[model samples]
Target chain A: MNQNKNALLLLTGISLFMAACGTSKTGLITIQEQGSFAVGGKVIASPGTFDPYKPTPAGQTFHGDHAYVFYQIPPKARKYPLVMWHGIGQFSKTWETTPDGREGYQNIFLRRGFGVYVLDQPRRGNAGRSTAAGTINPTPDEQQWFGTFRVGIWPNYFEGVQFARDTATLNQYFRSMVPNVGPIDIGVTTDAAAALFQKIGPGVLVTHSHSGGMGWLTAIKNQNVKGIVAYEPGSGFLFPEGEVPAPIEMAGGQMAAVGVPMSQFMQLTKIPIIIYYGDFIPEKPSDNPGTDGWRARMVMARLWRDAVNRHGGDVTVVHLPEVGLKGNTHFPFSDLNNLQVADLMSKFLKDKKLD
Target chain B: MNQNKNALLLLTGISLFMAACGTSKTGLITIQEQGSFAVGGKVIASPGTFDPYKPTPAGQTFHGDHAYVFYQIPPKARKYPLVMWHGIGQFSKTWETTPDGREGYQNIFLRRGFGVYVLDQPRRGNAGRSTAAGTINPTPDEQQWFGTFRVGIWPNYFEGVQFARDTATLNQYFRSMVPNVGPIDIGVTTDAAAALFQKIGPGVLVTHSHSGGMGWLTAIKNQNVKGIVAYEPGSGFLFPEGEVPAPIEMAGGQMAAVGVPMSQFMQLTKIPIIIYYGDFIPEKPSDNPGTDGWRARMVMARLWRDAVNRHGGDVTVVHLPEVGLKGNTHFPFSDLNNLQVADLMSKFLKDKKLD
Candidate 1:
């Protein structure tokens, strides 16, 4: 390989890379209005705020940790509000545009006639920035990020070969990674979801990976919620195949917090539930579950589905590989096949008469 | 681009392509007595040779279709053989090496400790040339091949954006395509399959797409068929959701060639049945079915699944997209996700105690 040839190869690779990108400025659906708003936060005093000697008072303080929700309503929407809760380390941006730069689920959902509400959950992304200092942060390492999501086990790029087949795509995928501080504050998330439902009225809930449990929590909070579609939610299924899943986490109103089993959360059984697990989940030793987290979640889901259905709750538990769909990561909605997965979820919602 | 730059780019592309290839001659699994042998052919009388001016009377001739099979018995193999039957237009080669030059299912099965038998069914691939001519001839065009196989619907490469996202890989896929000129003669295929089982002894039948129906026919042919994992089997699911499927085709001298409704598939109940349909199948309208053929097949599958389950048949019907695995074409086996899917299939067989 000569210098001239190498230069041309670089140019060629650059050209190919550039070709993968496209503008998301417009699509078949037009947004009636799109804007951001804030809700729910604790007041914390800052050291100084335009006061040289006198710091801000305790009674009148700055609002921090409030979730910032960005919403886009389609002019010709048929379905009510469809709130999207992202996974860990992700925010509203996850649903706005993909790594490949195409219109993300927010737009896709709107185009398909669902009013989209993308939530910036607490302690992550947009919401984390507004929090008071001292977040229990960890190093924002790509390897850790990939592992936590059960993306794959890899000492290097050679492993999980199917997940990220090419180096070019891998580069782009890493660019989309973000950092999260401490553990998720379930109370804050539940409140955010509740406030959104209160403001927009509940319709359907679409939660992905880490946010899967959020759908359940939010549904418990809002009575207006019609149905839920959890895409590999952080929510755990039950243990031992047919047993009831552990109770949903309940925040104390003003006292001790209590756990509420899904069955006791009577509203859950009223609506249809569909839980989807992507392909290549480690059923055997070869598959990666990061720390057996994903496998546990899947087992929990299976148990949940059985419990729910047995209790007259409409539930569909899907393991992607069982259906012959492989190579799907935790984030199926953002994969090369995102649109297809969305379509499948949309159908489930529609079939349940949620839409 | 200038001529100098263009020349460099071409050279660069060639070098990059050459880099992707590696010797398949060696891998984790070692080949054991791998070669092709013919089965079933009719003996006919022909004009003799050695006399230039006058033809000699009645010499021997062969008339039967040749069945070429390549077998590799593993060192520590399972109790029975694992036979693969390809769909239309494919042969044993479909299971030998993938389009991308990776290990194919036959080798994968062998690696997993199973004695593998790959069949080149009559009127397809290597078996096509061996058949006495004038069989139901049909042109195997690339255009039809791409479409019928559900690769994508493209009048040209410019359309169906998802179909050819990576032109490099798509080109590699096309290189693996082989031509088969003709409609399959069911009698010949059934005979060939029966002959194979007779020699190898009945085991597990792993059939893909068009040959899915063959699994059923073969199960009818050999009493030793322990189980079946139909990867989009050609046998259509029935009509109106409740109708019985059409009768299985039978060769002459088979006393009972009657069509059995799923309800009467008592044999199916004894063995596990797994049907896999890949992603992006249009229950709606955006996906491709190549003149709706794929969709029709899927519909038939759904009906078949429902009836089988109703009749106490141990059937698992999977529509890939439904489980959040998307963007799979008819050949998930050759997709970037092939190995993962194989892993899932292997697990299924093991679960059923077939392996």
Candidate 2:
């Protein structure tokens, strides 16, 4: 009887271990709710009697200039959800699975018990309808984007870049670039983003690349943006009306700061802000325009940070290489080291009491 | 000793049962491989010395007219994957999830151990860059689509329509409409689709609404298309030379069939084809153009079916309401009763030995 009891105990232990293994392999996530909605668009009605039958474009109405938001809330979620906005030539897919088939920030944050809401800003991605007219010329500019995105110089990988170097992976990365159906209007986009904040209530705003400037404008427009996490903000840096800095000249073009009222600029100082930059940016200007352009952006970023901090604002700029985290591209959140990056983000959220 | 053995068995059984329940709740799916790629785009080089710095569109090259495909394969996937193409004014999101947050065809089919590939055809959705120029006017057209999609007449729901009647659900449904970055060119889209088939190799093609015509054209272009499943094909029906039917006049516009050589038309007869139409299509012309337009399409569909059958092809057309599944809209696969619709599709797949 004693031997049998010992055997039973061992058997139970083994069975429990097997069950635990099964759970990890499946990686099952429990989602309490998930859905999507649109906000902040105007309806344009054509002048004339509308006819359902024999309808013509001249006598039709259109609903556009709206932002679309898709959300998934885990059960018993945290106090605030993370609202993710994409950069130029991208949509919500930037926050989804990466080109290499790895989990993106959307699932990463959700797995950590925080709700994730992704947006397709007006005139791009799912929000492809626009009020303004713009032409999309079929220009072979992937090489330019490839260099600009810091994945690497065209046809060559930067030493120790975080992106997958396989042809298939590159194919996906290039294919992900989309075009705007209409000309990009900063005012229109910010208005739509401000509306998104109003609809979602208080939440942390996450912005990338071209959307960095829009984040500040949106936060100023609405008080619901409790915090901000910006990744490689390339343009649209805002300064007080009289304190705007001189334009930084680059090989491709010039980067100039936008000016807003001191009252509006002060709103940014009310929130905790964090900005992250990736690897390969030279400390000084380089001969290559692709690498040198990022160098200028970094200089501008520090200036932006100083401006915000002078006003008693909470701002922290992290250069991944400076912190010993290396090989990251412009898209650090979706790179191979995304999980480690996510952990760093989580720590900041906890420290700021934003999570 | 006997009592101890019995207790051990009970404990093991309970633990195993608990593990199974956990698996169901988490809905853990094991993905073997997943990624995306682009196919069939041409490179247009501009004349001049290309300058990386001070880049101008006049001295740049552009790549457009490509189809983007995102794919995932499950462990031990079925023999042939399903390549899903969306309709006009939409993208790959049509297959990801419904507006009401239910599983769309992508996940539904993925769960059944089949590989799934969703596409963003050239100049639409993710493949937004276009070789042709077009204007995207901000026209208020949601009500037009609302009625045309058979969800219901504007501001009302068709009796027992298989759509969520809540405001939020309706908001998402309307917001899903997108505009084309360029004019819709059948030749360009079909060429890109043919390239996708060549890359994927030996798969079933699934087309919805505006893409229904493209599916037939794609199959004719590539022998890799093993079968086709079309949902409410609006236009681009092909008949043999000298056998084109007279254009069907509708209140909104006219529906015309294209003429192709007998040799190319015969290619469609080599594979099995199935078509599905939803509710609210009148048997005869009605005063309401929205409903009447579909009636004309249905008539064309039968004519197309008869033509194919005459050429010794196997084709099946299913009207949901006629078969006791009522109140379906244009998007039956993503409707509230999507699971039931999936099962119906599965039955057809198995019967035709295409599973």
What C-alpha lDDT does candidate 1 achieve relative to the native structure?
Answer: 0.58
Question: In model 1, what is the error at residue B180, expressed in angstroms?
Answer: 65
Docking class of 1: incorrect
Candidate 2, DockQ to 2 decimals? 0.34
- Against the true structure, what is each candidate's TM-score? 0.42, 0.85
lDDT of 2 at A240: 94
For model 1, residues B1-355, the per-residue Cα lDDT tens digits are 6999999999988654433221122322322222234444333335443221121232322233545464656444688778888876555545755555455676567667688887767544334333333222112234445555666544343233224456444433443332332346766777778777786776888888768876776676676788888887655232232354554322111111225554335566667888888764556332233525455566667667776677676788877667655666777665556777787788888888887
Candidate 1 stretches greater than 4 Å from native: A1-28, A44-59, A129-133, A136-140, A148-150, A155-168, A181-183, A236-264, A285-291, B1-355
Q: Mark the 10 consecutive residues where model 2 chain B has the least summed lDDT.
A: B21-30
Docking verdict class for candidate 2? acceptable
Give Cα distance to truth, residue A278, candidate 1, Å: 0.5
